[model samples]
Target: PRAAAAEHADQLFAGLQDPALYRFIAEAPPTDVEALRARYTRLATRRSPDGRQAWLNWAIWSFAEEAYVGYVQATVEAGEADIAYVVFQDYWGRGYARKAVAEMMGLLREAHGVAGFRATVDTRNHRSRALLEALGFECVAIHADAEVIHGRSPTRPSIG
Candidate 1:
């Protein structure tokens, strides 16, 4: 399969559409599998159009659920990976997202020479902001869009 193949997109599409998940971000979920498949097709390249960034996406497979419960995505550029993740509505409050994000950061550093990290979250999404904070990310900037982007070394977070 591709970096984000249609098959995997098909499987995860429905679960990715829970209304609660869209509250903090723009763009509603795809109305159908075909839309998702087409989108994933573009995401498979692992690179941005300008060739300045690398796109990484991984499905989070849960042993307990015996299924893919979520995904971690990163946009790597200039030695920093702007990361994002989602662990579908039914699977929230579990440690799956935390574990996956941690592992993905580790991989980005060791495999891709990413020395710093960044993440943008809607300010209203306190849980997500806390999750990034818990992972040692510091709030570096808050934008007019009501979003915040974090910047810090992954291993040396000054959580206070």
Candidate 2:
């Protein structure tokens, strides 16, 4: 789905309760399914309240596994999309996050006129930083004791 929906609250909320998933981030799991439903209901709008930015969220469903792995999201403004994503702890090292994020960036550029992409990865998450680099994102700035902000243009470079 293009946006988080209340209907997926139960399934998604279950994956979110894994404490290991929050090891590098500050957010704790939602207290209950109802809270997740409420949050998703608001996110379903897919637009910031003031309308200056577009909120794009997609739930990841795996056919082979018959489960919801996680999600990818972006906030877009002025031709740049700020990206974020997650792949539940159990699905780690399977390349799901990389694939999902690449697809999201492609859709944003082709359908939404997004020319650039950006992300802030927690400094301690070395795998995430490496993944972004593999996606052609260059680290543009770093927040001390926090995240490293990176950016990438839509067009990847050709082989030399």
Candidate 3:
């Protein structure tokens, strides 16, 4: 995984503009390329490991179609990391998010030695909740309207 770069701004902008992709996400999609570029620029600088946190991000790509699809990220603090992923709506249900997230979990475990992962999913996003459950995450808490799921490396029995 590599840091997000400005070169990816165009495809990233296009992917984020899909309303279906952001339906369950808290933040609405940026309305223009300039906004997307600014966001990407901020993400790029987060690659440097500060004492308080480590931010990792990667652009999702489809080799078969030779295009950028989406992104996956993990923000590590203390001994745990919060993970999230997004794929263009057109690529939804194709297992791209699953593959990317699984690989990220492994990378975070092996490379960073993170003890656990946390993911916040919209309560109504059953698909995302199911994916996390399949990965052995258990819903440990709820905040506002979102469910907070937690998982450890090697995985434990899932809880509701």
The top-ranked prediction according to lDDT is: 2
lDDT of each: 0.80, 0.83, 0.82
Alpha-carbon shift of residue 21 in model 3 (angstroms): 2.0
Point out where model 2 deviates above 4 Å. 154-160
Q: TM-score order of candidates, best first? A: 2, 1, 3
Which lDDT tens digits does candidate 1 get at residues 31-96? Answer: 899888887777778888999999888888888998888888889998888888888988888877
Task: Candidate 2: give the clashing pairs.
Answer: none
Q: What is the lDDT of residue 58 in candidate 2?
A: 90
The best candidate in terms of TM-score: 2
Q: Candidate 2 at residue 111, lDDT? A: 89
Lowest-scoring 10 consecutive residues by lDDT in candidate 1? 151-160
> How well is each residue in 10-54 modelled by candidate 2, as lDDT tens digits?
889989999988877778999999998998888889899999999
What does the lDDT come to for candidate 3?
0.82
Model 3 off-target regions past 4 Å? 47-50, 155-160
Compose the digit string of candidate 3's lDDT tens values, residues 1-98. Answer: 34577678887887788889777887898888887778777777765445577878889888876888889999988779999999888887888788
Question: In candidate 3, which residue pairs get closer than 3 Å at backbone N, Cα or C atoms, i.e. clash?
Answer: none
